[model samples]
Target chain A: MQINLALAQIATKLGDVQSNLEKHLDLIEQAKARKADLLVFPELSLTGYVLQDLVATVAHKPTEDDPVFKHLLKASHDLDLVVGFVDEDSRHRFYIASAYLSGGRTLHVHHKVYLPTYGLFDEGRFFAWGDSVRSFDTRFGRVGMLICEDFWHASPPYLLWLDGADIMLFSSASPGRGLNDKEKLESARWVERVTKAYASMFTSFVAHSNRVGYEDGLLFWGGAVAYDPNGELIAQGPYFEEALTVASLDLNQLRRTRARLPLLRDERTNLVQKELDRILSK
Target chain B: MKIDLSINTNLARTILTAFIKSEITRADYSRAVINLSGGLDSALSLALTVEALGAENVLALRLPYRTSSPDSLEHAQLLVDQFKVRSETIDITPMVDPLFERDPQMSKTRKGNLMARARMIVLYDQSEVFKGLAVGTSNKTEILLGYSTQWGDSASAINPIGDLYKTQVRQLSQALGVPQPIIDKAPSADLWEGQTDEGELGFTYAEVDQLLYLLVDERYSPQECVEAGFDAKFVDVVVKRVRRSQFKRMQPPIAKLSNRTVGYDFLYLRDWGT
Candidate 1:
């Protein structure tokens, strides 16, 4: 299946969800005009990253008939949309989540499985960790979702592959932290390298959407990108600017690359699960 | 791992301006106030701030002591008029002299520190009155060498030129159209009547910039820096200064006894989501 994808890079305001919603709407319209099959936004695109105590204030449910969700649901009538949002569940537990809206409805919601809590990250303090890694059906094919730091773990892609995902979508708020834009920064070439490597390893099309703009002192360099199943770069966006990187992905190529490598076919899932259970239980 | 020390001056100017603009506006402030000392760093910072926030939104404070050079005030006034930004010339001699007079044992060094702190007090006080943020002027070389008066000139709401080395500061200052007199003149803290920074520091910024590039940016060891044509003793001296002044670069390290110590665990961004 041939599909046109747009990775929308935007600068989100930290607490002003209503103002950010306006930005998202404008970008969504731009993507639609460009004839993009799917438009993917950065992690927490509705509310900026580094929320600290504002996470609770900005967190909202996708089920609510809020104006932001209403606008997205209206816009999703024509184009497929994948957007990151701070989700507040029925129990009032908050999660860093992405909602996949297709055909005017919320099809799938993926909470972030990993919450980074080290230097320059404090996600674990506010949001609860997700427990599942699964793929859902889409118009293009089966697609899996991963949040920013979740891509750091090798297991999520492998699990998504086992779950039969043809496309892996990543939403990131990665900051450009270092000297050289080419090598040292987190938003540097290393991100592209890892993104491509993951695509080839899983034999799935990978779309990475990162945001740009400075918040407080941290600067996020927008280097949104996507790669083909063959680990070839299909489209890449600029650094430190708001842009939409569009790409064409042929789903049939996933089968061709998987046939070439056959890593997914000869995998030992049961043994791996048993080993993980033993190691984790101890 | 050869690193290019050369920066695209135009791109550097654009990026720094964007950074300053975003940092100030994102924190919900529309204005920036920088202490213009008639030096390369302060002038460059003021130019960038004016570009970022527009001349009307920028405020340049000229805080000078009684012993300060007349040429310094003239240079600062030239920049203020050139930029067409809001400016105020405050004499810090009155606030600092009473404390000095109370103690005859107070040395010039202590008096200098008092003047620097007094300037910061005025900047912060005006920051509240004008509803603007304090932009810093210290360059990377001085920050690394601990050449600044701590909690004095170092205290600012944000700093744009702090990451730029002294050599880069000069290049950028020229690129940003800083006055030639300020750019050409020897750097000085002007604590006393005729004190120059190079005269007291025993080295020039140009030489130290290259040494710091080799030592810090390139990750060259002191021995490697010596081999790369820096004097062995100078390399050792610069390395020791950078090492011992690490505290100046970071927030005071709190002992990790609590579940959430201030700088240890409570190291979260302030003015977030406002």
Candidate 2:
């Protein structure tokens, strides 16, 4: 099977929910024109990153049949949307979450498990850590979702693979850091290395969508990329610019890679479970 | 691997135009105000400002003291005429001299700081009158060396040229069509007569900028910088100055008695959108 995916590496105005909602509608149309089956946007693509208390201003229950997601719900009839938004619970707790929307409904919402608290990130102050991780069935395959910081940990991807994820979608707002000899951004290199390794290791395709444009002094590097099941970079986006990157994912290759490696079939789930239980018990 | 630190002028032009316009318009200000010093740095900023907000919406103010070089005023006029921006000239000698007169034993360093701060006061007051934000012109090399007055020239609503090093500043200035004479002239803060910036610091900007890129941007250690062809003494001095001036780069530290401190926990600027 073949599916088209578009990475929406777009810039968002901070705390402007109304305009951001409109922007999503417009980009969705552009992706639809490209005949994309799925479109993935960066983390906090709706309200933007580093919002501080302004996160509250844009936080809304996307599941409540609110008007915010009305147009997006209407647009999801033809494709699936993995979008990042500030989610507010009925109890008033906030989470930096990615909502998997298909056929005019939210299939699943994955909150960011790892909230980066140190050095340049203060997300712990504004959001509660998500304690759950699981892969959900989609038209393409069983898919797992991870926000920016959660993908940095080795555990989430491994666990997601164990849960039967054939594809991992990473929504990120990673800031550009340092410079290489070619003047390429350091964070861009780091993202590609980690994503490609995870793809080859688990025999799963990884798609990372990072935002671009400046927020105060922080510049989010757009270099969104997609990797094949064999860990080869299939498509690359530009840096420091808004780009709609489209790539084709082949399911036959996904099967072949897993069949050849059999890394998942060789797993000892019981032993790993016992070890994790022991560690958690302490 | 050696990185080419030169900027892509076309991309720089587009990004800076978008940045200035978006940042200013998002803050509900349609106009921009800048201190035009007739130097390469300010000239580049002024050109970008004109492109972003249009020459009509941009204001160029020349704040000169009695000791300021005549070339400074003349070069500033080149930009004002080149862009056809709204212009003003304010003599700052009258404003800062009263304070300097009271302290007959004041050092040149003290007097420079006072003048730097006095100029900021005039620019800010014009900002209120003109209803525009004060755009900054300091370059990254000066910021890294703490070579600027703390609450003076460094104070601005927005800074466009702060990220570019002195080397990149010269490069961008040339791309932006800055006058060749200004770019080639010896850099100075004009704190006193015949005082050049490199002479006062005892180091050339070209030498320091290359060393700084290796040390800070590439994560090279002082020893690595020396190995990369910078003099050991130069690396040591730059490292010490950067470390010594860390306070100037940050907000004042708030004691963490409570669970949330001002600078640490509640770190948002006051003018956040509602």
Candidate 3:
């Protein structure tokens, strides 16, 4: 199977939700025009970075019957749209989430697991940490979604890979400042290397998208990239600027890659489970 | 002319003490590290830290640039001598010159900021080595006027003096018996030749502190500020600075999916225990 994917590197302005949504709509149209089967956006593409107190003021709920969700569903008809948002749950805690829009409806929302609360990041001060790892079935294959800090921890993506996810999508609004851009690139490289290395053993692909712009005092450097099952860079975007980059992946290649490197066939889950239990135990 | 005013020393001490205690508990910090600049703000913050965490738990770092005034060093030494606490001196000139040589076009403001950040880098490095927290010394006056640099002097693991006005800092410093020279000397960033805080800010420390007290502490509007005898121009300057520097006070916005954030989320420092 051949899959065409478009990653939108939208430049976001702080606290400008309406303008950001308009930009997202325009990019969705652009992705459609490029004849892409799947489109991914940066984290929080609707509200921009550093919304500060405006998050409390601007964040809205998206119920099954909400117009915003309905609008996105209509736009994403026949295409798989993965976009980030700040959603208010029933418990009233805000979550940094990404919603999967396909078949003219909201399919699922994945909340960020690891909330960074040190240095320039204060996610712990904002959103609640999600407890679940979600993977959905698509026409292309079984796909998994993870937010920025989710990929930093080994457990989430590792579980997704083990659970038969053929592809992983990462969305991030990682800040671009000082050495952050370099860190972001290095992090993306690590994700690609680790996930695709796993993918080569198990056969999967990974798509990573990040945002770009000056929001408040922070800068978001967009360096979107993707890797094939063999950990080869199939597509790479520019740093510190916005651009939509697309790539084509063949599922047959993934199968062949896994056939050559059959490390997953070696049964070692029992040993690994013991080690994990020891580490996670109180 | 004695104006009718309420001066609750207990209330003031309680507010400062509560803020310090809460800040430490929130960050899970056991100790604090501060730069004793021999200025009122630093002196007040040092005193507060010592009062809240004891002298044994607080470490004072006296960082002097090559061109720092002799009086500044004297006052810093005076504080250490009075408190009988451990203090160390690290000259930042050597660390900052190479960067300046490479980027000669760096402005005085930029150089000052680099010096501030370099000093903080040392303080934080020491904090890691000592297992302590870096306490900030910026006063509310400076925060209101955008007088500090982001990630430079403005960066800290915690700030005990950020909400206090400059005049309040002086009063607290005197109450804490910080040396007279530190309290008396004109405020300066000591970034370059012939530089003073008032010269750059276009207002005296006394005037700015008074205006800020009436405006920010009292929550006076701009018109009310002018009617209270503050120059409209000065009020406008401070208000504009506060508005422009509002970004420094917040976390970078992540797209909200959950309901509670620092700005949007309703979690309090007290909630950490729960």
Candidate 4:
């Protein structure tokens, strides 16, 4: 099966939810026009980053009764949409979250586990840590979703892979500054290599999306990218600017790559679990 | 000359002592040197340094160019006379003239920056000689506007005034008993003839400082600023300056290969013990 995916490089404003929502709607139309089966947006697509204490008031709980969720559901009815937002749970503490929507309803939602706190980031002050890793069965493949800092950790992706995800979709709103262009590109390359290496081992594909624009003295450098099961970069977008990058991945390639590499077949999970348990115990 | 609040000298002394103790602990710095501009910012910084590190340990360097007003030197001399701290005057004309001879196209702004950097180089050299740290004198307003030159006036081992707005700097200067002429005169880099900071920025320091106090320190949005009766253009200019000069606030980005690289993978300050 071949799946068409599009990643949007959205120009977001800090603390301006209405303008950001309008931009999101405009970009969704653009993605639909491009004939994309799946559209992925950046992290905090609704409310921008560096919102400080305002995030506590602005964070939305995505329920069936919520207007924001209903609007998103309506948009995603015709196309598979993946977007990021600040999510509030039963505890009232918010989490940086990503939602996958299909057929006018949320297919699955994943909460970002890692809340960056140091330097310019004070995510820990705004967001509560999430425990469970989320994955869902899609028409194209078993899909896993991770927000900005989630993929940075090895545990989340490894657990998702173990949970039988064949494709991983990562959304980010990575901040940029002077001389950060090279650093941003290198980070994308690192993510591609690591995710692709895992994909090659598990016979999977990965799609990455990031935002672009200046928000609170920080620039979001968007350079969305994709990797096939063979760990090759199939598509990549421009840096320090907004763009929509599309890539078509064939599921058959996963099987062929797995057959050639045989890394997954050769895995000794029993030994790996024992080692993991030992580390956890300590 | 007018005191907004009554001066409780005992309370003032206590506050000064606490500020000094906290700053020393925060930066883990012992000795400090102030670039004595004979301006309010530098005067307040000198007082802060003396209070924080003592008069004996806080050294003052007065770098006056040939074109600098005579009053600036006299004001600086007054500070030394009152404080009884170690002092030196280095004529920057000698150092700056040679650089300008090599690069004739150097603007007055560039020349002022060269003079500032030359002063810093001298200060750093003396810092090593005196085993002291270079203390910055720029207020938050100047820093937010990128008014100070990098590796020049912006260069410091540690800064205490980086968070205080210009209005607050004035208040602090008054509280510290900085000379009246230095406090009364218009703020300038003294880069060129007839140059004033407000003239260059196209807005009064008082207005800019108030706007910044609301925007950064108080967390007011552009909309909120307008709602609070600030001019829309003034708010726009302040926001634009903050956005355009973000590079000055951040560390130079480094490419990441290691699991923890500065700016990308690593997220903590170097002094922050994990």
Full-model lDDT for every candidate: 0.85, 0.86, 0.75, 0.76
lDDT of 3 by residue, A24-105 (tens): 8888888888888999998888776555455665465544476456667778775888888888887788888888888776
Candidate 3 overall Cα lDDT vs. reference?
0.75
Ranking by lDDT: 2, 1, 4, 3
lDDT of 4 by residue, A56-130 (tens): 666776666776777778888778888788888877878888888888878888888888887667888767888
Q: Is candidate 1 or candidate 2 better by lDDT?
A: 2
Off by over 4 Å in 4: A177-189, B1-274
Candidate 3 TM-score versus the reference: 0.52
| Interface DockQ of each model | 0.32, 0.24, 0.02, 0.02
Residue A270 error for model 3, in Å?
2.6
Candidate 2 residue lDDT tens string, A58-170: 88766637778776777788899988999988888899999988998888899999999987788998898888889999888899999988999999999899998999999
Q: Among these predicted structures, which one has the highest lDDT?
A: 2
DockQ, structure candidate 4: 0.02
Error of 4 at B98 (Å): 31
Over B1-274, each residue of candidate 4 has an lDDT whose tens digit, in order, gives: 1112222343333334444444454456678787888777888778878886789988899999989977778888889877778998889898889889998888887888888899889989888887778878888899998888878888877666665677767766777777777889998887677788999999998777777767875688998988888899889988998899888877787877888676764433322210
Error of 4 at A185 (Å): 5.1
Give the per-residue lDDT digits (tens) of candidate 1, residues B51-160. Answer: 89999999899998888999889889989999999899999988988899999999889988998899999999999988999999998999999998889999998898
Q: For candidate 1, give fnat to 2 decimals.
A: 0.38
Count clashes in each candidate, considering only residues at least 3 apart in sequence or on different chains: 0, 0, 21, 0
Better of 1 and 4 by lDDT: 1
